[model samples]
Target: MSEVAFRLFAERGFDNTTVEQIAAAAGLSRTTFFRYFGTKEELVLGRVGEFGREIADALAARPAGERPWEALRRAFDVIAEPRPGETGAPMDIIRLLSDACALMTRQWEKTQGWQSMLVPEISRRLGGPGPATDMRAGALVAAAISCLDAATDAWTAGGGVVSLADLTDQAMGVLREPGDVPG
Candidate 1:
């Protein structure tokens, strides 16, 4: 199903690919497709809720002494790493997202959701939520997501010459630097 979705997304663009088309391409009924994915965006994003949960779990598992931001940074590094059997080229996916406002909005919402889920875990790790802990968690998660987005955009614009890790590091550097403007 994902393979079909990826090919259709690649060929026709994400916004142009209908759920019915994806379903037909996959030799499944529309009902079956809906059963598998709640929406066309889900077909493209593909189990992102699961990935977010995994990220949260990873953040929760970090060493007790590590700062919440550090734990999240480490967790993000691991999440951003390419794994076996992932569908669609990262650059292509990034480009598709950049070109689609709806996808970009969805991506932003997903990032926010991930961050929200991470906050309690981070607060727990910090032994409780205070103004400082809350602020740090929000800032760290926001910075990480911003960096990931910028890195993806840079990688796409560079014709995929730069690895996602490199882009991520660049994003992290921008975040760490004092007085850097938000992109």
Candidate 2:
């Protein structure tokens, strides 16, 4: 259903594509579509809830010795990295979602949702939450998100010539000093 809707969204604009069209494309009734997705936006942003949990779990499981940036990068990679034998599908979904400004905004909004959850967790991992700890957590989360967004944009623009994981590593590397490489 999501793939069908994504194809329709790619062919037609996101705003121009309607739930009826998505339902028809999927060969499902409007009622069934509503049963699965309450709104068209859900077709794009729905995975956030599921993936968000995975990301949070990954973050929580990171070694306490890891730097916040490295920890966050690994957490993102947990969700973003494709499984074996699956290469282009994840990138295809990202590119399709990127084609729409609305979806892009939703992506950021979802990231913010993650940020909200991560800040306190990261703070706890850093010791405890306070002005300084909270700020550090917030800054790390924001920077990691920026890197992910930039990497995703580059991957989409470059037609995925570069591996997404490499791009992600490079983007996260930008957080470190020129002489410093993140492990």
Candidate 3:
């Protein structure tokens, strides 16, 4: 279903494509399409929300004693790796989302949603719950997401010539610097 939708989105352009078109292309009924996806946006960006859970789960799978920031970075390695049956490259999906104004806004919302899924584990790594730990966890999650956005923006601007995982690590690494941000 997604492969069909993605190909259509890629070929026809996301804004130009319609749910009915996607359904017909995939040989599914409109009702069946609605059963599977609520909207055209869902067909494209649905996996995004799921990636939050995957990242959180990845964080959980890291060594118990790993540093919080390091664990988070390792967790994101799962994201840089292509999905089992993804129809587009990570760069292609980034381009797709950037092409549509509404999806870009929704992507921001969905990415922000990752914080809630991540805070508990981060807090645990910060030595369990408390005002300081919770606050720190929230900040760390925000910082991590910011690093991802920075990496993504860089990737888009640089023609995706660099591996996104490497760019992400570079963004995260910049934060670990003891000196001011490089100009």
Top lDDT model: 3
TM-score, predicted candidate 3 vs. hidden true structure: 0.88
Question: Which portions of model 2 miss their true places by more than 4 Å?
Answer: 3-18, 25-27, 84-89, 130-133, 178-183
**How many clashing residue pairs appear in each of the predictions shown?**
0, 0, 0
- Model 3 lDDT tens row, 57-112: 99999998878888988998776655555575555678788788879989999999
lDDT (10s digit) by residue, model 2, range 1-183 = 887886777778788999999999899999999999889887777666556677788888999888667788898875567767432255555876777777778777886777776776677766655525567667777788889888988888898889788899999887777535323
What are the TM-scores, per candidate, against the unseen true structure?
0.77, 0.79, 0.88
Runs in model 1 lying further than 4 Å from the true structure: 88-95, 130-133, 177-183
- In Å, residue 158's CA in model 3 sits off its true spot by 1.6
Which wins on TM-score, candidate 2 or candidate 3?
Answer: 3
The alpha-carbon lDDT assigned to residue 112 of candidate 3 equals 97
For model 3 the local lDDT of residue 157 reads: 80
lDDT of 3 at 155: 79
Point out the higher-scoring one by TM-score: 1 or 3. Answer: 3
2 versus 3: better lDDT goes to: 3
Off by over 4 Å in 3: 83-85, 88-91, 130-133, 178-183
In terms of TM-score, the best-performing candidate is 3
RMSD of each: 4.3, 3.5, 3.6
> Clashing pairs in model 1?
none
